[model samples]
Target: MLYYATTGALPIPSGKPQYQQPSYYTSGDSTYSVSPPEDLDASVSSASGVASYGNSYSVTTSYAGSSQGEYDSTGSASGVDLNEYMQERFAATFDPLPLDKCTAKQAQTSGHLNAKHRELLELQAKAQARLAKTRARFAQGLEDAREVRNDLEWTQKKVASLKAKASKKHSKEYTKARERYPSPDMY
Candidate 1:
């Protein structure tokens, strides 16, 4: 609701009809009336329409006391009428429940347990924690396994070449390596 002011500022006072009423301001005639809504506290100020909520919001229009953009809201029912309707509807629709007919067995089972149950509950909690920690570690992953497998294959090939060269009488260092490191797979 953006209002465009054609002549000047909107809401020219009703008492000062010269600013709002076309007849009073330009045409030189005099006739005006204020019409309020069923749910509004409305009035007129020098031919300007004045409508407002209790004190929260307000709207005024100045176009011969009947602007197309003006709006009024004023409808509220009292509290007593609403309360009576709700009570009557509830009595007709609702029924009460009976809790007075229980047997001896029902009364005895509602009692609390002794100390042994509490100890068992604590033991169950510890078992669950241990299981959770094991699952978390296993979930860390398998990349290290793949790396170790690759290293083992490379070391095996290196050892086989060293053993082949060690058969040569002049290769004394290969013999020393075989004694010192054993084999990568053994470790």
Candidate 2:
């Protein structure tokens, strides 16, 4: 039977193995009795006294059921200790690792490794940033060089066109002058 401490209600036994109901439950320094239902024809009588523990009291209850005449003093109907059964069921299965396996030196080494990893990541980021800047500068310089080359080609073409025009314009004048001032070899 489960006892509710807050509501002080007696819960009907459900699927649990046959065990004698707890007479009383202790909380802090007070003891509260859990009386059986009236329909069960049971009478509960409790005696309370100060326990060995400081300021705490204990209760001893006598249950007289009509069918059983008197409750089992062992608090178990089948002679099995519930506490021992629970302890066996909930016992730890494995041993904990020794403290020596996790030393302060190992923790310090782990911290140092983590710091170095962070440093490496930061350095890689800086290097990538520098590489990106270098690539951008290289691309800009190539564009500038292309523009300069186009300008130089245009200037050269213009100069060649001007030279051709000047030579064609001066050709007739040069012929007339040469005819007027004949060479001594011709005389």
Candidate 3:
């Protein structure tokens, strides 16, 4: 539905200044030239629209009679050029509007999520610390159990040695007493 045309050279009609379309829209460095058609009326609206950077310029041609071209040019929306009208409207309507900020609800929701994430991280750290402490305590308990078992073994060995010595001494005393005292029948 949109058509874009580009040509190398276009002839300008005799006895009138030619109107040209700009090449670049952003920089405004492109030149605007016009070649009025031969059959075109004298009151025809020029293609050169109002353009402004620092200063404003209007290139619309004035017509004498109330011709069709003159009537069309003098229409209600025709007083100011399209580009000028758009620029003015944009400046008036768009320039004053401020940028929107995050709403209170959104801020609160995000804060809650952040707090929850931090809480989860803290809990994980605590769990790991507790697990390490439990492991350390378990190892300590195992060491204590091993120490108690070794003490019990040492006590058992000492008691066995004392029992063997007491048995030997009591046997010797019994033998000496029997040799020293005779039986009643023998006496």
Candidate 4:
């Protein structure tokens, strides 16, 4: 939250939760009680008359004695409580696997082939790498096939035109070209 401080050099400490006394230094001759904002809101909301301050305006907040901000968090539970709850949930979520691996078996009892497990894991990793490489090569092969197919079709059309042109002429070069470019029946 951004605080708009209207006074000289206010202390908004983040290092700790508790504070001894968050006192206000007034240059005038008035001092205000350190009441919680919600409490003041409640009081002001239920008021029959308006209250006024002369020189300095005060909106006070307090948490009982040294345990400041203990019950003053955004919600009913504080940050520390929330962190502990999350840690417990994390531990509970993953604490009960089968303990099949060597390190996990070592953590429990010692009755598993640790070396074979490691070897199998290494083999699985190698197999996965090979599979990924094969897929990439397969995609490249498809791209190359597309280019090859387009070139083949274009070359076939050009040769077909040449074959037709060669049949219309009786020159030696045209005869050689007509024979050099075989007809589709040859395939």
Tell me the tens digit of each residue's lDDT in model 2 across 1-187: 2113432343444454233446776778898765433222123222232222321122233344433244333434345556676667766653335545567668989999999999999999999999999999999999999999999999989987975776588988756766888746687
Off by over 4 Å in 1: 1-121, 137-149, 165-187
- Candidates ranked, most accurate by TM-score first: 3, 2, 4, 1
- Structural similarity to truth (TM-score) of each candidate: 0.24, 0.39, 0.41, 0.33
The local distance difference test score of each candidate is 0.47, 0.57, 0.54, 0.53
Model 4 residue 156 CA deviation in Å: 0.6
User: In candidate 2, how many Å is residue 56 off?
Assistant: 43
Q: Which candidate, 1 or 3, has the higher lDDT?
A: 3
Prediction-by-prediction clash tally? 8, 0, 6, 0
lDDT of 1 by residue, 1-187 (tens): 2122233333535352332322222123543332222232234222234443232222223454454543222221332343456778987786543333344445544433435567779999999999898787766546667788899999989987876867585467766876787876687
Q: What local lDDT score does residue 177 receive in model 2, on the 0 to 100 scale? A: 68
lDDT for residue 73 in candidate 3, whole number 0-100: 25
**Which candidate should be chosen as best, given lDDT against the real structure?**
2
The local distance difference test score of model 3 is 0.54
lDDT of 2: 0.57
The runs of at least 3 residues in candidate 3 whose Cα sits more than 4 Å from the true structure, single-residue gaps closed, are 1-9, 13-106, 171-187
Whole-model lDDT, model 1: 0.47
